[model samples]
Target: MKNYLFLFLCLLTQNLFSQENVDKKALKKEYFTTAEIDVKPEFPGGGEKMYSFIAKNYKIPESKEKIIGKIYIVFIVETDGSILDVKITKDIGHGTGEEAIRVIKMFPKWKPGEKNGEKVRVQYQIPISIN
Candidate 1:
């Protein structure tokens, strides 16, 4: 009976939170964007750099099995030449998603994207393979 009551209270509290102050504008901007990407990745060079950075910094926890798997991370390279709004579009579980985010966050500021040669927001994607 106590456990049931606790579970009910937890659910009820979550519902109340859902009704709390909501900034629909900020939420919309985060999910809906019209920004254009500026940089064309240098393919092997860019990917290789990302891989080396990840290998230098990321260590797959024991929870991840040795089988190779992939994670795709999405982020914005802001005009200040900084990485922001980073997240994993696809998760392989076992902390891969979280680790991917960490590596992206740790990256040195990139040469920010340009629109007509002026700095502008650009979206970037990175994929890391786990073994």
Candidate 2:
């Protein structure tokens, strides 16, 4: 009985470690920057249209002190033309960062960037100036 229990424990430990390794390998995906990619991702229309969308959708948070400056948002444009991992790299306080994230999340599917003529994930960043 003791020997059987020890064998089962060893098998379980080995299985767990193998699964962890597989998970790490499967979760790793290559991401390229705008400069590294042959084609950069873009909104449905273009820069002007994107800005228009943001202007139309973004709402400033009411604050005692006026909020001004630039907020930088970073995200990954996946190969399927979907946005993921949206984050605010820079914020100027007053809940503007969170607001920017909210607006970005509402955006429609973007044209995915490409490299070597194949669609690839790309890290993208944009700065929004608030005044």
- List clash counts for every candidate, in order: 0, 0
Give the worst 10-residue stretch by lDDT in candidate 2: 24-33
Considering only N, C-alpha and C atoms within 3 Å, which residue pairs clash in candidate 1?
none
**Cα error of candidate 2 at position 18, Å:** 5.8
Residue 124 CA displacement from its true place in model 2, Å? 0.2
* lDDT digits (tens) for residues 24-119 of candidate 2: 978866698999989999999999999999999999999999888999999999898888999998899999999999999998999999898999
- Whole-model lDDT per candidate: 0.71, 0.94
On TM-score, the leading prediction is 2
lDDT digits (tens) for residues 17-119 of candidate 1: 7766354544533321324534532223466776788899997866635646999988877767677899889888877788788878898877665555666
TM-score of each: 0.65, 0.80
Query: What is the TM-score (0 to 1) of candidate 1?
Result: 0.65
Worst 10 residues of 1 by lDDT: 28-37
